[model samples]
Target: MNIKEKYEMSKKEYEKWGLDVDKILEELSRVKISIHCWQGDDVTGFEKTQNALSGGIAATGNYPGKARNGEELRKDLDKALSLIPGKHKVNLHAIYAETDGEVVERDQLKPEHFKKWVDWAKKNGLGLDFNPTIFSHPKAADGLTLSSPNKEIRDFWIRHCMASRSIGEYFGRELGQTCLTNIWIPDGYKDVPSDRMGPRKRLKESLDEIFSQKIDKKYNLDCVESKVFGLGAEAYTVGSSEFYISYAARNNIMSLMDTGHYHPTEVVSDKLSAMLLFNDKVALHVSRPVRWDSDHVILFDDEIKELSKEIVRNNALGRVIIGLDFFDASINRIAAWTIGSRNMIKSLLSAMLTPNDKLKELQDTGNFTERLALMEEFKTYPMGDIWNYYCEKNNVPVAEKWLDNVKDYERTELSKRS
Candidate 1:
């Protein structure tokens, strides 16, 4: 039978278990996943530089057809968004600003620099998110930014972050929605440091100075991200997870958790409930990490399913800001975006389609054996039928047909990049 007929059959099966398939689809339609812009250019922003990547971050691989400029990057983003089904937003780094053939220092950046991006987002009917580019600059060559012992360096980064917040406010004010401005500095030592406390203290003061001016939260929400370690900062990272979580809780700001930012054994799914308990809202940088902080493209894997289940089970979708954060220059950039994005949406849909209420009831009534059995039985549900129907409803290609579109685009557009 067709997808609709199969979905109808699956819908009836779910109905018998006290689940509403249509309601789940409706909820999934409303979710807006923010796609990162850096994926198109392998984290290489529009800046005049000839140095290796700094800030404890590196983009591996040299796949051809990387976006050469802002126009091409936006064009690539447009193509990727067309294939994805739901409403979405674009996440931009400060370095992506369009400077009219003139050099603009990070500290001197103004909202006018990003006026083109705001206009583009408005035209495309997408929301905008912002981030301060603290790495890949001459000042960051020493692998320290906000936490630098050099007063000049610390002040420069502080001013840049503060300016970024203003730009974020501008995006929100112009677009009629709050913009999330996230701060993640790659400031740590490659070798063991005897003065870890000193650097952290400096970082705290710098953050306080950057946030001294209180912008309205409605226009711009501030978020701080923490990492366990970075390439050179493996021995010591000033902005550790513990520091940011405490700082965010104390300052009433949002804490962002990058899935690849922690130890391999630690998962963000288990941390969501704790974050929701303390903070009014939280943010996520969803990416796949293999062994280390290798920002591989996302897949519909076990951790992703569990992460989505946590969000659905707690009903915390409204409180969580979901955004993609990976750059794989080894494959077609547009395909990387589409595949990772679709898989993210698929995982969420799977979670929404689950009979969580029934399973919770089974557990609440102390029926452990039945709960395990029902959970396993849910693995066999006809999720593909519902997913295909969702794609059809959203006017996107269903099943594996999207691969054809990507291949055609590569042949006509991406192949011509060189």
Candidate 2:
């Protein structure tokens, strides 16, 4: 049968379970998954620099057709967005600023540096998010920024972060949406530190200076991200999860949780509900981590499903800002974007289709057996049919059919990059 016919049958089946398929589809459609710009160019921004990726993060592989400039990156983004359904936003780092061939230091950046991006976002009906590029620079050669003990080095990063906030405000003002300006530093010690408090103190002071100039919350929101450890800085990290969560709580700002930033055994899904209780909002950098913070492409795994379920069950959809963060140059860049984004959407849809209320009722009443049975039964539900209908409604191809478009673009557009 056709998608519409199958959806009609699925709708009846879900209604028998007291679930509204229409409501699930409508809610899922409204979610805007902010696609990170770094994925398109494999985290290699347009900045004219010889510095390699520092700070615990690195994009592996030398895949051809990686965006070489802002124009090409945006072009790739447009192509990827066409195959993905939903009104989404684009996340940009400071290094992506188009300076028209002039050398503009990160600290010297202004809203003017990103006028082209704002214009492109406006033309595409997408909102924009911002991040301060604290790594991959000469200043960060020592594997420190913001938390750097050197006064001059600390001050330089502070200025850059402040400038990033201004640029974020400009994006929100121009695009008519609040731009999330997230700060994640790679400052840590490769070996055990003699004094851990010193770097944390310096990092806190740097943050205080950066947030000193307040922009209207209507146009811009601030967030700080934490990491347990990084590649070179394995022994100690200044911005640990405990540090930023407390800072964000006390300062009334948002905390960003990257899925890959924590230890392998710990999952962000378990922490979502608790965070929602204290903070007004939270942001997510969703990606799959193989061993550490490897930034692998997302898969439809158990963790992702649980994460989406927590967001949906807690009714934190509006309170949570979802964004994709991963770079895998080993495969087709456009396909990577499409696959990860589509899986993210699928996870959310799965969560929405779940009868959380009924399960909660059973659990609250101590009907453990029924709850377990119902949960297992849900696994066999017609989720694929509902998803196919969603894609059709969004004017995107159903199932693996979208791969055809990506292959065509690879041959016609990406192949000509050289």
- State residue 217's C-alpha deviation in candidate 2, in Å: 0.6
lDDT per residue for candidate 1 within 1-418, as digits (tens), equals 9888988987887788777889888888888888999999998887654346678777889888999888899989989998999888999998888888788898999999988888889998889999999998889999899999999999999999999999999999999879999999999999999998999999999999988977988899999999999998989999999999988888889999999999999999999988888877889999999999999999999999999998898898888999999999899899999999999999998888888888889999999999999888888888888899999899998988988998998888889988
TM-score, per-candidate, Cα-based:
0.98, 0.99
Candidate with maximal lDDT: 2
Q: Candidate 2, residues 143-164: lDDT per residue as tens digits?
A: 9899887999999999999999
What candidate 2 gets wrong by more than 4 Å, as runs, is none
Task: Look at candidate 1 and give me any clashing residue pairs.
Answer: none
Model 2: how far is 251 from its true place, Å? Answer: 0.8
